[model samples]
Target chain A: MTGSRRQRVAKAVFLHAAALVVVFLMAFPLYGLLLTSLQPESVIRSRELSIIPQTLYFEHFRAVLAEGHIVPLRRALVNSTTVSALTAVLCLLVGLPAAYALSRLRVPGRNVILGALVSVYFLPTTIFLIPMFVLLVRWGIDDTVFSLVLAYTGFILPFVIWILKTFIDRLPLQIEEAARIDGCSHWQVMIRIVLPMARPGVLAAFVFAFILSWVEFLTPLIFTSSLRMTTVALGMFRSTIDIQVGQQAAAAVLTLLPVALLMLVCQRLITQVLMSGADK
Target chain B: MQAVPDSPAIGGQDEWTRAPGTLRRRETAFSLSLVAPALILVAGIYLYPAVYTLILSFARFDMAALEIGRWVGLGNYKALFANAAFVDAIWRTIYFGLLIAVGATVSGFLIALLLNEEFYGRTLLRVVVVLPWAVPPVVAGVLWGQMFHADVGFVNALLFRIGLIENYRIWFGDGRTALHIIALAEVWKAIPFMVLFMLAGLQSLPPQLHEAAAVDGATAWQRFRHIVFPLMLPIIIPLMLIQFVWAMKAFDTIFVLTRGGPAGQTTTLNYFVYVEGFQSFDMGRASAAAYSLLVVTLGVVLMVTVLRRYAALRKATA
Candidate 1:
């Protein structure tokens, strides 16, 4: 009996140790990024590396955050925010009604529409890359954030609509029926009855759309030029090519701030969307 | 048909109270209208472009004139197949996919199983594990790139300090190591999703089965091999398939890390398309390559669907 008890204790200790190592390995890169960004250039450029910062450095942050610098970080952040916020808003504005139609009303060929959307969601972004670039450029919107908005809206709309549909599917039918009986139109039923009930899903879909757009690299990189139009992701990449490791790290940390905050607030909902097989 | 109910909120009360078929038709119109914008966006942005790309694949593109010159009829595809570099990219992409599918899934399973065991800080660990998922794919490239930098890289400094290497070597300057490093970046990002799925699968498992197994005096490995693994297979297969598809399409990390380089060694099919389309302006060949990638993705999707059906059939027969 004592031997079995001791073995169980040993197992627990081993498990904890293993968990610690996994977490440390998984998190060390991010920690290193932050540490490298904070350390002075001397420490950063040194052949020897230390996990701990000897002296704090603000120049990289200041330089990255400065106005009118190449791949200007402030403008990039603003552009990213504008594009991401627009993507989220546009997705909700367009996605909510479609989700409602698909979820509640008997839209014709609902399954087909849903399947096509899912397939498109699963399809490679490269399939649409060339034509989108040509079309956007031809339309004289290629270098604009609005162009990014249009592209991201189309890209993120499928996921948003799918998630919102799932959310609306869970909503009770009785409330909607009562609203319709009380002389509410279909739009009213959607806006007044189902919308409030599916608020969590709405928030989740919005945040998901926002984060998806925010972290995007391919579209912005392809669609936009000029430092003002640079996205945080693109800026980080270009900065690396410029060999500004400290600034690149600073840019990365700054770029990740909003996403980290969003995840903190809506971790469970985002996890649901991810595990729901959206293929992050 | 269900009765057309009152809908005073709509502007036309007579329209709502009109002939029953009219009201129903109007309702259907409303539903269709509600669904129209989304479908239009998808069709206009995705479907139209995708079809255009497919059509362009078989045609000769005149870059100067910026239009289709002639229908070459698989000329582009033939060119792609004939090119040794393109062939290498296809095989290299497959290799990268295999690495990620195996590496992420296995490590994900182990970490998830460890987390499944009761321990302090499990919640914290799960959160920390998911941090990578929040990092943008490009930023993940940045993190890993910085970590393995030749001069100040933590990997190099630590390896040297530990006597693993006499000197700090450029890891990305070589083809094989570059591809492996990018794969590592992707695997690191993908593990969170895999673990998330595995944990959900693990938690949903019935506790009594494990208890019964323990009562039978089965070793941990024996229980895992006999029961847990088999039960987890359904989840694992689809998860790996998804990972494989993501791996095949991996571009951002590769773009940041090597730009498909150290002499085009690490270029995947996706990166090949980017280079052909944008850099080389070989629109025709790029379109063909893109279609090939689509076919590969669709093949995986079909495989997953068929495998799932087969699994279901086997279970029923058993």
Candidate 2:
């Protein structure tokens, strides 16, 4: 029995060691980013770079945060926040009802529409880039945050609808019927019952939409000009070109902050959504 | 089961239990109304632009007027196909996409398998895996770019210390190595997503199957080969299809890292379209190239779907 117990312990140790190595591989880049961002430029450029950081330097962060240091990242943060928030709200407003209809009521050409949405979801945004750019330019909204919001919604709405549909599909129809028996109309039942039950899914979809828009690079790169109009992503890219390694690292860290926080807060919920999405 | 006039309408149970024809009509109307806004958004944004681009692919685009100048049927396509550089980019994109797909899948499977085992700190490991997933592709590119920087990079520092190389090598400056480095960045970002799906697949499997196999004295590898892999196919196949499409769509990493540099070795179809449309302003040829990419993506999806169906049929008969 002791021999078997020792063997079990050894196996456990082996499993943990393997798991830690994998974790290190995954987390190493993030660690490097954080370390580079925190250390002084001298330390970063030093010949003997250590795995562990020994200093806490805020100069890079300070420089990045100040105005005119690669387009004022604070303003870019606000812009990204505003665009992503609007995109999420729009996704919910436009996606929820559609998801509801598809999951509950039989829409015409349901299969065909669903298939098309799947294809659009998989499509590279380059396919839409040229014409969308032309249309936006004609509409005189190409460089605005609102245009970014619209473009983001165009791509992200498919995913939002698909995810919301998955959530709504899992809901018991009995409660919806119960609401109907209570003399509520279809919209009333949806607004009152289904919406409340699917809050977790709704929240998940909203967070994901926000993250997707927040991290988007190509749309903002193509659609906007000028540093003031740029996003955190574009600003960071522009900074990289400027070869301000310290500032770039700091900006990258800042860019990661909101997304990291969202992931931390919604990890479980996001996992649930992802798993459900995979099942589909 | 009979609908009767005597049933009370107050409960609204009669409304549900009543004949379906009228209710279905109302339901269909309501459904359509609810779906209309989403349909309009998609139609305006995706469908309209897609159709316009399709037409633009066959016509000369007037940049000044921002409209079609003249119809040049197949001219742009012929030009693209005739360009050896463009043709090489097409093949390069396929190669890079296959590398990303295969790398992400194998690594994702191994990591998912590791995470599936019961161990301490597993939750922490799972959570940290999502870091790469949340990191923007551009930022990931910068991060990895720094790691692989020709000088002052940790990779060089470590490699030098370990005697793996005598000097710090330029990773991105070389055409041969640039594409692979970008793929590595993409694979890093893609693995968490794949792991999320693969872990879900693994978790959904019945434990009894494994326990029974163990009781039959099957080794872990044998049990996995016989039981786990087959059951995981439904999730794996579709996941891989999406991954391939995503890898093809990947451009930010390439954009940030190489900008299709080192004599355009890293230029994939996605970047080619961007450069053609935006930089070169040859909207006609760019549109044609974009359509070519779309066709290839659709072809891949179709091929995978057919293959899956064939495999399922074979399994059923077997």
- Taking all chains together, each candidate's TM-score versus the true structure is 0.94, 0.93
Model 2 stretches astray by more than 4 angstroms: A1-10, A239-241, B1-23, B304-318
Q: Evaluated with DockQ, which candidate comes out highest?
A: 2
Give the distance in Å from residue A224's predicted Cα in candidate 1 to where it truly belongs: 1.3
> How does candidate 2 fare on TM-score?
0.93
Clash pairs for candidate 1? none
lDDT of 1: 0.85
Clash list (residue pairs), candidate 2: none
Please write out the lDDT profile of model 2 over residues A102-149, one tens digit for every residue: 887768788777888877877778888899999889888888988999
Residue-by-residue lDDT tens digits, candidate 1, B99-188:
999999999999999879887888899888888988888889989999999887999999999999998999999899999999999999
